[model samples]
Target: MRNLAEKPYVREEQREVQTVRRQIRKTFTRAEKGLLTLIGAAIVFSAILMVSNYASMYTQNQEISQLQNDISQQQQYNEGLEHQVSELSDPERILNIAEENGMELNEDNVRVLQP
Candidate 1:
């Protein structure tokens, strides 16, 4: 402050203005902006994919359950058919069917075939 304008300062006489200084500057161009947008879109897409996967898994489980129920019903139906077959063991049904086709029950009238 003595004579800054009248005399020149020495090289080591100048004092430091600040102990530390920090500054941050950010700049965005069209390409950088587009990159940020793409990143955001990718995050959203990932979320959608996760939701879709969960939905597919849930639907598959439901389908499996329905198929198991269908199998149980079909098994019951087959068992009922088997029971009916066991009950119809009388020879009268066969004789009636044979007579309807004009087939006689005589020993010579029957043809024997073996496989």
Candidate 2:
């Protein structure tokens, strides 16, 4: 009965020693803390890089959209100018303008060009 009582005390002491060892193991070393801090900083830098890249892409897209709109407007204005040119270049209108300027049409000197 006395030996059995001593065994329980010994077991309790062993348990306390193991608990203390586990606590000690849970604490971080200096090198491990530095490694963790480096990894955290790297993660933050990568996140900032991604956000900046996205912002740059967004700004470029807006510029491209604006350039496309300007090109479309210029194309429409060019089409309008082409239509006006065609109206002004009618053969009948040219003949009337020549007559109004006191010019005579001689068929012998007239040249008809085909496109």
Specify the highest-lDDT model's number. 2
lDDT of each: 0.89, 0.91
Error of 2 at 94 (Å): 0.8
Show the lowest summed lDDT stretch of 10 residues, model 1. 1-10
What's model 2's TM-score? 0.75
lDDT of 1 by residue, 23-99 (tens): 86778999999999999999999999999999999999999999999999999999999988976855688888889
Candidate 1 matches the true fold with a TM-score of 0.56
TM-scores for every candidate against the unseen true structure:
0.56, 0.75
How far does residue 86 in candidate 2 sit from its true spot (Å)? 0.7
How well does candidate 1 score on lDDT at residue 63? 100
Candidate 1 clash pair list: none
